[model samples]
Target chain A: MIGIAAPLGYAAYLSFFQDRMIGGNVFVGFDNYRRALGDELFRAGLWRVLLFLLVQVPVMLGLALVAALAVDSGRLRKPGLFRIGIFVPYAVPAVVASLMWGYLYGDRFGLVGQIGDLLHVDMPDFLGSSWMLASIGNVVTWEYVGYNMLILYAALRTVPHELYEAAEMDGAGEFRKAWSIKLPAVRSALVLATVFSIIGTFQLFNEPNVMQSLAPGVISTSYTPNMYAYNLAFNGQQFNYSAAVAVVLGGVTAIVAYAVQIRSMRKEQGK
Target chain B: MSVNTPARRRPRRASNALTIAMGLMLLYALLPLIWLFMSSTKDSASLTSGFGLWFGHGFHLFDNIGDVLSYDDGIYLRWFGNTLLYAVVGAGGAAFLSTAAGYGLAKYRFRGRTALSAVVLGAIAIPGTALAVPTYLLFSKVGIVDTPWAVLLPSLVSPFGVYLMRVYAAEAVPDSMLEAARIDGSGEVRTFFTISLRLLAPGFVTVLLFALVATWNNYFLPLIVLSNPKWFPLTVGLNQWNSLATGAAGSGATTTNFYPLVITGSLLAIVPLVVAFLFLQRFWQSGLAAGSVKE
Candidate 1:
C-alpha cells in the first residue's frame, strides 16, 4: 500500500493544486486538470499513443500468435532454437534496443544508408517524422513478440493432448484442430497479453526517449504522455500540471484495460 | 495405403514450408543483434564508413571493449555494478515479499483480504509511469530523491508478482499439507517457510525472473529520480553515452564520439540476462503458464 497506493493518492492530491513561481504551492481546484485537458501537447501525445496501440499491438500480437502456433505444431525444424532465438531479444534492455535500432535507422551512418548506397537508390528515412512512430513500433515489436509468443506457446502446451487426439480421430486436419482447439484454449492468455500490451503502450517512454537524441528535431519533449509529464515536472517546473497529466493518463489506462478485461470476460461467457 | 501416403506426404511438405517460414522469422529477429556484434568490432571511423552488415578492414573489438570498460574513470563498470545491485536486491526482495503475501492471501482468510487483492489488481492496471512523478515528488519530500532508495524502494513493489504468486499458491499449495504441518506442531510461519515454500519454488523463480528483467530494463524511474551519475544504472548511463556520441549531451559537448564504446557496452550489459534466460527459460515459461493460464 505504501508503495502503490500512497503515491497514487498523493499524485491525485497534487493534481488539484498548482506550483507557482511567487505563490509557491497553492490549491487551484480543478484548474490543473482544466489545463491538462486543454493542453495541445498532451492531447497530441495521447492521440499518437492511441494510434500506436491500434497499429502496433495487433501487429506484434499477430506475429506472436503465428510464432506460437508454428512452434506448437511440432512441424518446424529445431523449434527450440527458433523459440530461443526469437526470445533472445527480450533479454536486451529497451535502451540498448532503441540505441541499436536508432543506429540502424540513421540515414547517414546506418545499415540502410549503406544498402542504399550500394544500390544507388534513395532509401526512405526510417527516422524521418513521418516514419518515426513506425520505427519505434518496429523496435517494440522486436523486443516483445517473443515474450508474448512464449506466453501463448506455454498456454498451448497446457491443452490436453487427448483433445487433439480426439479431434484427430474425428478426421480433423491440422488447421482445423489449431483453429478450434488451440485458439480457444489460449484466449485467456491472449487477453492477458492484450492487457499487458495496452498498459505498455500507455507507458511508452523508453524507446522514444532513448532515441530522442538520435532524432532530436522529430521527438520533442512532449513526444509521449510519460515523457511530457517528466519534462513538465523536471524541465518546465510544472509539477502540479505534470501530476494532473499523469493522473489523466493513469485513469485512461485503467479504464481501457478494465474495458478489455470485461469485454473478454463477456465474450467468454457468450461463447 | 494410398490414403496414408498422401496424408504423410502432405504433412512433410507442410513441415518444410513451416521450417522455411520460421527460418525467415529467426533471421528477422537475429539481424539487428548480428549487426550489433558486427559493428561493435569496428573503429569509430569504420563504424559509419564500412558496411554495417559485415566486418571492417581490421578488428577493433578488443579495443572497443577495453575503452568501454575503462573510459571516464570506468563509469561503465560502475553503472554495471549499480544495475547488478538494483536488480538483485530489488528483484530478490520483491519475489520474497510477493511469495509471502501471495501465500497468505491464498491460504489464509483475514480481514481486508478482498480489499487488499482488489488494490493489487487495480495497481496492476495503472501504468507504472503514471505513478512515477508522484513517487518522485514524495521521495523528494522525504529526501530520498537522487539516492538509491529512490530507485530501490519503488522497485521492491511488484504488484503483478504478488498477483501471479497468489494464483500459483492457490493452486500449488494444498491446505492439507498445511494442516499436516500444523498437526506436527509447526507454527504458521514455520509451516509456510518449511512446507509451502518448497511447493512455490517454480512460481518463486517465475516471479523472480520477471522482476529481475523489469529492474534490469528499467530506465524511466531512474532517469527521473536520480540525478547523480554515481547512482545511474546502465540503461540511463548508456543513454547518456549515446547522447555524447551524437553530440547531443546538454552543454558538456565533446567532439569525440563514443559509438564503439556504447555499442560494446550495450552488448556487455545484455550478456548476463541473455545467459540467464538461455539457462532458465523453461522454468520461467512453465511457471508463467501455471500462474497465468487459469480458467
Candidate 2:
C-alpha cells in the first residue's frame, strides 16, 4: 500500500489542485486547460516542439543507428576509439556544449567567421531567425547520437551468432542481412530509442536557454514548451497558468508516447 | 564459412566505404572540440582576425587559465569544488538508494511490486525539467532555496537510475542465490550487501557513471535552486560568464581578453568530464553490454 500510495498520492495531489496547491488559489475546474489551449504562445510552443520532433527525431535516430551498425560490424580497426570519440560529447555539460557551439556560430569571432574571411564569402548567420531551430537541432544531434548509438550497439551485440551465420549460409548480402535479421532483432531497442528521443525532444531546455544569449532575437521565451513554461512561472509569476501548461504538455507527451507504443505492439503482433 | 567468398569480396569494398564514412563522421564529432582547443590559445585581438582555428602569435593559454581561475576571488574554483561535492555525494547517494530500491523491487514479490514498477516507469518518462518547478516550490516552502541540499536532494531521486538498477539487478542477481543465502541464515541486509551487491558490481558502476554524469552536467536544477554564484556548478558559472560577456560586448568594452578566460574556462570544465570518461569508459562499455541482454 505504501508503494502504491506514494506515487499515486503524489500524482493525485499534483493533478487535482496543483495550481491552487502551489499558489493558494481557489479550484477552477478545467479553466487552466482552457487558458492553455487559448494561449497563442502555448500553441506556438507546441507546434515548434512538434516540428522539432518531426525533423530531429528521425535524423538523430538514423545517424545513431548507422553509427551503431558501423561500429558493431567489426570492420573498423579502432571501433573503440571512434566510440569513445563520439561519446565524449555526451559527457560535456549541455550548457558548456551550447556555449562552445555558440562561439563557433558567432558571426565575428567564430571559426565560421574566420573561414568565411579566408574564402572571401559571407558566412551565413547560424543564429539567425530562419536557422536557429536547425542550429539547435545540430547541437542536439551532436550531443545525443553517440548516446543512442551506444544503446543500439549494445542491443546489436546481443544478436545471436547463429542468426548471422544462417543469413550468411543463405547467401544473404550484408544489406539484406541487416534488413532481414539485424534490423528485426534490434526492433525493440529502436522503439526504446525513439520513445526516449520523443520525450527528450519535448524536454528541450538547456541548449535553447543557453543559446538564447547568442541569438536573443531568434529564440523567444516560448521557443519550446519547457522554456515557455519557465518564463510563465518565473518571469510572468503566473505559476497557476504555467502549471496548467506543464500538465497539458505532459499529457501530450504521454498520449503520443502511449500511442506509439500501442501501434508498435500491434505491428509486432501482426508480424 | 566459405559459402560466399565472391560476395565477401564485394562486402570488403562496401566495408571500405563504410570505414571512410565512419572516419569522416568521427572527424565531424571532434570538430567543435578542435575549435575549442584552437580558440583557447588566441588573444582577444586575434580572436576575430580570421585565424580562429590556427595558432595566434600570442600564446596566452597559461594567462587565460590564470584569469579564469582568479576571476572574482577564485570563484571558479569554488564552483568547481561545489560541483565535485554535488557529483560525488549526490550521485553516490543516488546509486546506493536506487540499488537498494531496485533490489527490493526485483528480488521481492511484494504486495505492490507491479504498481511500484509502473510508478518508476512513469517517473522515468517524466522529464526532469517538468518537475523542476514543483521541486523548486516544495524546496522553497521548506526554505531550502539556494542551498546545496536542494540540488543534492533532487539529484538523489533519479527514476531512470532506479529503473536501470531494477533491470540490472534482475539480470545479474539470481533468485536461487538469495534463497541459498536465506537458508544459510544470512540477514536480508547481509545477503544484499555481501552477495547481491558484489554480484551487481558492473551494474553499480553503470549506475554510478550515469548518475555521476547526470548530476555533474545538471544545470537547470542548480540554476533554479542556487541564486548564489558561490554555490553554482560549472554549467551555471560558465553561463554567468557568457551573460557577462554579452553585456560587455554590448557596452563595447575594449578591455583585456575576456574571450580567452571564457575559452579556457570552458576547456577546464570539460577536462574533469573527459578524465572521468577515460577512466570509466572500459567499465561503462562492459557494464552496458553485461547489464543488457546477453548474446
Candidate 3:
C-alpha cells in the first residue's frame, strides 16, 4: 500500500510546488501544470509518442499473434527451437539491443553501409529524422514480439485438444479453425498483450536514450514524455515541472489502459 | 480409422509454407544476435573496416573480451558484479515478497481482498515514471538515493508478480489440502512454507524469472537513483561506454577503444539470461497458462 500510494501522493504534492532561484521552493499551485500544457516540446513529445503507440503497438502485436499462431499450429517443424530462438531477444537488455541496432544502422561504418557499398545503391539512413521513429519501432517490435508470442502460445496451450478435434470434424480447415476457434480462445491473452504493449510503448525510453548519441540531432531532449521528464529533472533541474509532466503522462497512460481493459471486459460480457 | 488417420496426419504434417514463414521470423530475431556475436570478435579497427555480418581477419573474440575485462581499472567487471548483486537481491526479494503476499491474498479471508486485488491490478497500469520520480525524491530525503537499496526497494514491489501469484495460488493450492494441514496442527505459516510452497514451485520460478529479467534489464530506476559509477548496473555501465565510444559525453576521457568492449559486453551480458530462458521454458509456459489462461 505504501509502495504505490506514498510515492504517487508525494509526486502529486511535489507537482504543486516549484523551486526558484531567489525565493527558494515556493508553492505554485497549478502554474507548473499550466506551463507543461503550454510547453511546445512537451506537447510535441506527447504527440510523437501517441503516434508511436498507434503504429507500433498494432504492428508488434500483429507480428506476435502471427508468430504465436504459427508455432501453435503444429505446422512448423522444430517449433520449440523457433520459439526459443525468437525469445532470445527479450533476454537482451534494451541498452544492448539499441547499441546493436544503432551500430547496424550506422551508414558509414555498420552493416547497411557495407551492404549499400556491395550493391552499389544508396542505403536509406535508418537513424535519420524521417526514419528514426520507425527504426525505433522495429527495435521495439523485435524485442517484444517473442515475449507476447509466449503469452498467446501459452493461452493456446490451454485450449482443450477436443476443441480442435471438434473443429476438424466440422470440416473446418486450419485457417477457418484459427479464425473462429483459436482467436476467441486466446482473446483475453491478446487483450493482456495489448495492454502491456500500450504501457511499453508509452515507456519507450531505453532505445531512443541509448541511440541518442548515434543520432544526436534527430532525437532531442523532448523526444518522448519519459525522456522529457528525465531530461527536465536531470538535465534541466526542473523538478517541479518534471513531476507535473510525469503525472500528466502517467495519468494519460492509466486512463488509456483502463479504457482498454474496461472496453474489453464489456465486450467479453456482451458475448 | 481412415478418418482418424487423415485428421491426425493433417495436423502433424509440417507445412512447407509455414516452415518458411517461421524460418523468416527466426532469422529476423536471431540476425541481430548473430551480428552482435560476429562484431564482438573483431577489433575496433576491423569493426568499422570489415562487414558486420561476417568475421574479421583474425579471431579477436578473446582479445576483445580481455580488453572489456581489463579496461579502465576493470570497471566493466565492477559493473558486472554490481549487476549480479542487484539482480540476485532485487529479484530474489521480489519473488519472495510476491509469493508471500500473493498466498495471503489468495488463501486468506481478508477484509479488503477485492479492494486489495483491484489496487494491485491497477498498480500495474501506473507508469514507472509515476513511481520513480517520487521514489527518488523520498529516497533522497532519507539519504538512500545513491545506495543499492534505492533500486532494490522499488524493484521488490512487483504488482504484476503479486497478481500472477494470486491467480496461480487460487487454483494451485487446494482448500482441502490446507484444511488437512490445519487439522494436523500445523501453523498457517508452516503449512504455507511446507505444503503450499511446494505446489507453487513452478509459479514461483516463473515469477522469479520475470523479476530476474526485469531487474537485470532495469535502466530507468537505477539511472535516476545511482550516480556512483561503482554502483552502476550493466545497462547503465554499457550505455556509458557507448556514449564514450560515440564521443557523445564530450572529449577528454581516456578509455580510447570502447566500441569492441561495448559489443563484447553486450554479448556477455545476455548470455546468462538466455541460458536461463532455455532451461526454464517449460516452467514459464505452464506457470503462465495457470496465471493468465485460467484467469
What are the candidates' individual DockQ scores?
0.64, 0.48, 0.69
Give the Å error, residue A221, model 2.
1.1
Per-model tally of clashing residue pairs? 0, 0, 0
Best prediction by TM-score = 3
Better of 2 and 3 by DockQ: 3
How many Å off is the CA of A80 in candidate 3?
Answer: 0.7
lDDT string for model 3 (A15-37, tens) is 99998888999998999999998
lDDT-superior candidate, 1 or 3 = 1
> C-alpha displacement of A11 in model 2, angstroms?
8.7
Which digits, one per residue and each the tens of the lDDT, describe model 1 over residues B68-141?
Answer: 98898999999999999999999999999999988888999999999999988888898887788889889999
Instruction: Tell me the TM-score of chain B in each candidate.
Output: 0.93, 0.91, 0.95
Model 1 TM: 0.96
lDDT tens digits by residue: candidate 3, B1-295: 1235443325477789999988999999999999999988988788878888999989999998998899889998899988998899999999999999999999999799999999999899999987778888899999999988998898889999999999999989999999999999999989988999999999999999999999999999999999999999999999998888888888856443778888999999999999998888888878877877766
Better lDDT candidate (2, 3): 3
Candidate 1 overall lDDT versus native? 0.90
Q: Please give each candidate's TM-score.
A: 0.96, 0.93, 0.97
Residue-level lDDT of model 2, residues B144-207, one tens digit each, is: 9999998898778877777778888888899988999999999999898888999888878888
lDDT of 1 by residue, A131-223 (tens): 999999999999999999998998998888777766777788888988999999899999999999999999999999998999999999999
Which parts of model 3 are misplaced by more than 4 Å? Answer: B1-3, B6-11, B252-256
Candidate 3 CAPRI assessment class: medium
Task: Give the alpha-carbon lDDT of every model.
Answer: 0.90, 0.81, 0.89
What's the true lDDT of residue A269 in model 1? 97
